[model samples]
Target: MVWSALGILLSFALVTAVHCIFSIQMPSSLETVNGSCILIPCGFTIPQSLKESLKLPVSGIWRNGSRWFTGSTDIYNSSRKLNEIQGELLGDLLQKNCTSVLYNMGSKYSGTYYFRIETGFKYTFETPVQINVVDILPQPILSHARVSVKESTEVELTCTAPVPCPQQPPNLTWTPELGSITETLQTDETGSYTLSSVLRFVSSRSHHGESIKCLLQTQQHHSVSDHPCAITVLYAPKTQIEVNVSDPLYEGSNVTIFCSADANPEVTQIRWFREWRGNVSEINRTDLTFTMTKDRVGFYYCEAENIYGKQNSSKVSLNITEHSSEDGYDTLREGNSSTVKWLLGCCGAVLMLIILLTITLCFKRSRTRSMQGSNVNKSQIYVNFDKNFSNLQRESRDSECGVYSNVSNSQSKPASEAIYENSSI
Candidate 1:
């Protein structure tokens, strides 16, 4: 400790020999992130009177607050133990650079600071430097803890984070990813800045019982996060009723129909309904079943009701007939029942048209063949008559057998000679 005091004495003696040529450069203000390190850039010039003091040792010190010359308190000194302080003089005193570094900066290290230079017996203090140390980055706060809405309905949520400075504005983000965000800046009477992000989204049944979180970060990277809130999306009751029946459904047979619904907030009431003979009857239960008979041949359905609304399952008819082997009445399936009759009528019309065309073709073909048969019969009869007439003429000429024989010998001449004789005649 004595040696350190002697070093301070010599440092002041050397500065006393120097005239005023001193110049120091430092930033007016600086920002520091919590739990990080920062460098305070500083440079200084020595006086021309310190020529002989050049061989002397120079000492640099940084003290807390702006009152360094009045011995405010040493935060960093060349002669001080490093374990006693959280700052260091990084620049070399011989080069007139008084740059220093501060580690583990927090709110306690905030406010103005100054640098002091001691050369021999002379000491001088520089101007004050201000530092703004951000201790904690605020987390995002949501306006609503839990939000509930119906399907296809538009809902809104607001998330906000405090901003210490307008320059370093905090950013807000939301979970369950969404688009088309509406952002704004809000300030209250407290003079503190707040960054607000509005989320306008359409809630569906699929998003029920999910979490929505708002993340707040000072920067894009190395960001901080906040807690999450749950979402409860309400929707209309999803009614689905099942009617279980065994085969051979006849009179005085017991049947059970179970009705259920899936919905948020659960169903408050389940209603069973039966429609027969233009009369509507309501039965307040999960199932509506009675003695199956011809009188009970009608439509029945189940309805579920909640705070949101009500929904009904498809109707089932309880029909009893001699050929009705299965519990026959099921809802108009796939909307086919509404159009089946029209489709069948169209098919029957097309089939009748095709049959008429086929009959017409058969009639025309039969008529044509009958006319051809008549002509063929006429030609055959004429041929038969000509052959019979020739036979009769041959039999009648039998009495002139001798003359006939002579005429036959004359007519039996060579075909070419006969043709030549005929040509001459």
Candidate 2:
């Protein structure tokens, strides 16, 4: 049983010694701005045999070459010694944390580097990290929440930049500062820290077609900007109508109307509309200009349309009147005077005819009365003559009778009889 236990322990020790070795876990490549600092995130594992021999006051060293035996090119060291690249070791070496920072870096410090530890012994990691230095910081990447933006809607945009030096992270700024800006730190798939600036605001028509850019400010005060991105906004059209004349529209006069519109993507079609006697109708015109006639006497308006929407202009009214010539006033006055003279002549002729008719009727009435009076006088004279003749005859016969009676009676009547006889003789 004792020999079996010894063989089991030996097998376990061989496996541990073969698998456990000095190793490091960190980023393979990194980039930083000129004259700025760089952050190196590191964690390491020591051999299992050396874990028992670890002691206090551990020393961390970083060299600027692939192999440590090439030369004594130590850029950073935890021991008290002047370093070529100024930096600090933030991680605890006892806890196997080797996170560090390098300051005042330049192109001279750009290369592969290795990490080593010393505690009465020495161990170096086989894996190395590459550092790339640049004169100007790289431009930030800009992304939108949506591809198409609409007017008067809430929108968000993100501007991202790599944080090579987390201690002195780069700041992002937007041109025109259109909205509220907020910043946050995020880790990518490669385990690298990045900074993002989020902008939120409501879009407007005025912002359409405007260019926006994101600028990155590094710790070294170097400013870099991305390409300008234009904003496309979808909105309705604004319409207005213009005319050649402002007032005093006349019949038989030529008038022209113009339609103007301000919109995105341009106006597609324009139409003319008219309202007369409470009825609306469309004029058969599709172009910008419309011709007005005397019969088109009412309210007029125009409609402008595009792919987004349509808009109608304000209503304009027109009143048509008879046209009079300013230069022909004297000729018209002369013509009116002649017409008045002809009318007066006709009225005078009619008055003379009425007076003649009244005079003829008076003469006929006087002649009829005079003829009737003369006839009445002739009839009276005839009646008086017949009566007088009869009386004379009767008196003669009576005288003859009286003479005969006197003669026979022979008295005083004898003289009368004798006179009558003498007359006979």
Candidate 3:
């Protein structure tokens, strides 16, 4: 009890030195992660006349704005409990310290806060402290002057990404490869930056179904892209169809009519029609497998469709004959049939070559991937030119593996003798 009385006298003596002026020390700003606690490093000097005794103890309050202190919005107070707020003063006022702690930081906790101290001798209000709470940013926005255009026409598309902090702006990216890119920046009243990119390009039929995307990237390496905005390039189909029928189309002979279309946005549907007596009827279950009959011979055309509209192919007529030369139907419309046959055969050969190349590429890629998955730190193997592939003894760090390699050295052997240089594994 004597020690307590001595402490009280010491506090009273300290309170005798305080003046009207107080200095508040706070960092320029502070950043806090969501769902965490933050320490607002604060220090003050109140003329060293601060006495925090039980009879007339010094009290402090933290506010979220520059409003006058009335305890209505005090986040750190002992008597105000109208609402639940997790904060407290963690510094000794007698020692000229006013640091505080805030728990469970969230978006609502972000703002400029001021500290006010009320003592028996005097009161002082500190400068505001700014706080920023970070979370996943909002998605970028995409806009365009025109989303659809005709072939060779000009159009402009714009993408905007909002950066809540003027000091840190998000990176923006575009897709589908456009031309004449322009950038602009704007700041809102709240001192946030918004970056925009404009892509000026000429639309082509090839870009009908293509999409342009805008990606926003943050310093944390997190990225989000705008929803795909498909460009609708309008144009005619420029359609053409092939009628694959026997040259003669003789009675009782099989014939096939194959139709192909090329258009912007890729013909949504194909319609086959047989026109007779100036009237048209849709042909279903039609291909190159139909038997040539009187009813089957006529002018057939195909129509292709898309968002813009539909286009009709040139009509192709097939005349069925009762007789056929032993060599089959005539080659063409009075053209050489052998040349047509040669052209078709050449196309078939080229298609086969393409298929072979694709298979080889696929196999090579697969083999490379498999080799990458192997553990090659340590291995044991035996090589013998005369040994079979399966008989080779191989060991790996992970498991036993057998490598089959065929190496031939022609210079060291006769033409009839195949010499193995490093083929055995």
The digit string of per-residue lDDT tens for model 3 on 7-51 reads 999987777645535668876576655555566667776653343
Per-candidate alpha-carbon RMSD to the true structure: 16.2, 29.3, 32.7
lDDT of model 2 at residue 60? 91
Worst 10 residues of 2 by lDDT: 286-295
lDDT of 1 by residue, 1-425 (tens): 99999999999877776555566777777666675555677787667766456444677777776564564666777756673356666778777777777766666778787777766645555577787887655567888888877788887888887554454455777886654578888765433357888888888888888788887765422343355767888888999877776566766677777888998888999988888888989876655666677766678888888998999998887766465424244344535675897899999999999999999999999999999999999999999998888767765664568476546746898777756754543
Model 2, residue 344: displacement in angstroms?
A: 47
For candidate 3, the lDDT comes to 0.68
In terms of lDDT, model 2 sits at 0.81
Whole-model lDDT values for every prediction: 0.73, 0.81, 0.68
Index of the highest-TM-score prediction: 2
**Candidate with maximal lDDT:** 2
- Considering summed lDDT, which 10 consecutive residues are worst modelled in model 3? 397-406
CA shift of 396, model 1, Å: 99
User: What TM value does model 1 have?
Assistant: 0.43
